[model samples]
Target: MKTDSLVFWWRSLALLLAMGLLALVLQPFFGGTIALATMLVGVLGLLAYHLRNLHRLGRWLNDPGPETVPESYGAWEAAYGQLYRLVRSQGKSQRMLSAALDRFVAAGEAMPEGVVVLDSQDRIEWCNPKSMQHLGLDRKKDLGQHIAYLVRLPAFQQYLTAQDYSQPAILRNLAGGDSVLSVQLVPFDSTRKLLLTRDITQLERVQTVHRDFVANVSHELRTPLTVVGGFLETLLDLPDMDPASRESQLKLMFEQTGRMQRLVEDLLALSRLENGIEIREDRVDVRSLAQVLATEAGGLSKGRHTLRIELQEGAGGVRGNYDELHSAFGNLVSNAVRYTPDGGEIRLKWRVEDGCGAFSVEDSGLGIEAQHIPRLTERFYRVDRGRSRSTGGTGLGLAIVKHIAQRHQARLDISSEPGKGSCFCIRFPTNRLLEPEELVTSGQ
Candidate 1:
């Protein structure tokens, strides 16, 4: 090893002093052997220490280094320190990223709509809580399974193959009863896809109702107008006809005109109900209203049918527009009289049940089937079109009843069996039911 100037000068001084002492004493080997041995031992020990340090540095460079070292260790320690800090920073950043990802996943799981992630092979990689619930998925069994196999819906399978990201596809959930879903496929990364599902059962139902409403309205109007037009043409051709025949023709024309007017009025009422227009709410007495309806129905029936009243004593009154409630109840009673055969019994009942006021009309007429019961209140829906026409029904009676009941916060219950009889009941909510004192004071 090369020595510094100070070490070289000190060594030189030591050697000179040793030689001078030997010469002054005239001794042949004065201190020469001792001095040589001491110098040799000192130099060897220094070399060994330097070699060990060099070996340790080599090992550190080959493997991993310590976290800290003294500054005196020079470039080796500085380089190692920089590397350690860089690794530590990266580890902290990775932990933060992992935490953020966990939060995102948790949020998605809590959503109401379904979410699914898929790989390039169309295999399920991950799914959220809603997805499992909507699809009835068993996570342990479904993981890594082909999406088509698990879902098996034709629309969803087609969507996956089509790779069309512009629009979503609608699929019915066969596993769930009568549930519908709108599914969308989105490309995430180069090899991954995101499948989103939203429930649209209610929306679909509304759309269907809209479509049926338009068609039924058109048909109902067209039929009446056609009959009126044909009758007018016949009258024009028979201007000089016999007086008796002319009278009968005029009577028929008047009946058709009345039917048309009623149909138009019912149509207007339905429109108003659908648009949520505000109407005046007044207290209506069911007993008095039923009595009035019985009188009107009696006139319509010409006393051919028996009209019976079954009023419960002190039955609370309903809160609604008087005219609307009158029309609704009147339609039910009149329809019973018109539809029932001659001498048939039409019973009108008013009572309070379970803290709610209820009005029921029971008639011995042709009963409705179970399948038709749900849609009976739909506008212009006729179970027997020919019978409805023959009876001069506007085909909007039950629809009007349904609307009025809904507006008054009442529930309509219909019970009928084939060839037996039908009962239509309207139950008013407690809030819409009046106290007995109020009913008595109102002269109802």
Candidate 2:
């Protein structure tokens, strides 16, 4: 009842008392029956007015609003005003709640991680867009459906049954492919649960790579260290050994140390590149660089292979760090020299292809298989580990070249066949390339 309701009943009682007094005052002028009859009519009229007001109030309540609040007299007027205020206040609160809900839903939809709301029965209540993608859920079709039935992963089912959500469960290939998800259930409000999922595919890959890198580095260093240690022990034991045998053992030790040193240097170079070391942007003369590479390749080849240098007339230059580019180009040329058979031809070319400046090393040597080309840029990836070691390759040459290319906003392109030949090219975008006139304008 409204606070004004008491006023309404009090006012009604006061009017009834006044009517009774009027009936008593007219008792002598009329007669007892007439006066009583008059009082009864007054009472009936009051009852009819009250019933009519009640009917109006009931009708207004069916579609209650400030404009639709029924108007009345006396205390009823105050009652209608209070009821209208109450309805307006409730409407305002409902609107505020609705806006808050909208904002919360928008935030959830924009989140990167997946979020799903579940009822006490583990049935879907709502899910964000990411949850739909991560869990392969259909919002329209999957709502009110059991989450376990849709997910259908044994680990997930077991996790739900366990109900011990102290730790998250890792689900692999949940949505198929190589995808990984970290899923956890958080109980809220006694019955409802919040199902959170995060894509961990890249994280898992990075961890695997980290583990492999550590293992590979350990294995690579252990071999040479063991050989060096064994030789030292042998030499210490046999100090009176023949000079020829001693000299040979010393040379072997020197080679192993040199290999280890090279590996360390390559590792450091790769690290620097990966760590985004600032590059010194300078105009690098490609023609002169090619000649230098050719000379170095010839020395590395040691008359075992025929080396040739080709320079396109308008190939011009590129804007990049001179030493980094030199290192990149040197790696390609050296790789060709190392891998090619005796008397095989290694051609170093600097040319402008499709408006992009390109430096290519083509070798008629032991070529790589097609499948190995994709992973060639991975550190220490070798098609044949023994052959790579025998050829004095650090298995980081291509990886280094790739990083250098990326830093310079260029790309490394490799094409090879098993028997015929291989071509490795670093193509700099047109924007990075300088025409002959531009090079001259820059006083390079």
Which stretch of 10 consecutive residues in model 2 shows the poorest summed lDDT?
Answer: 435-444
Per-model lDDT: 0.79, 0.91
> Would you estimate the TM-scores of all the predictions?
0.74, 0.93
Error of 1 at 369 (Å): 3.9
**Relative to the unseen true structure, what is the C-alpha lDDT of residue 334 in candidate 1, on a scale of 0 to 100?**
81
lDDT tens per residue, model 1, 318-357: 7788888888898888888878888788999999889888
- Write down the lDDT that model 1 would get: 0.79
Report model 2's TM-score to 2 decimal places. Answer: 0.93
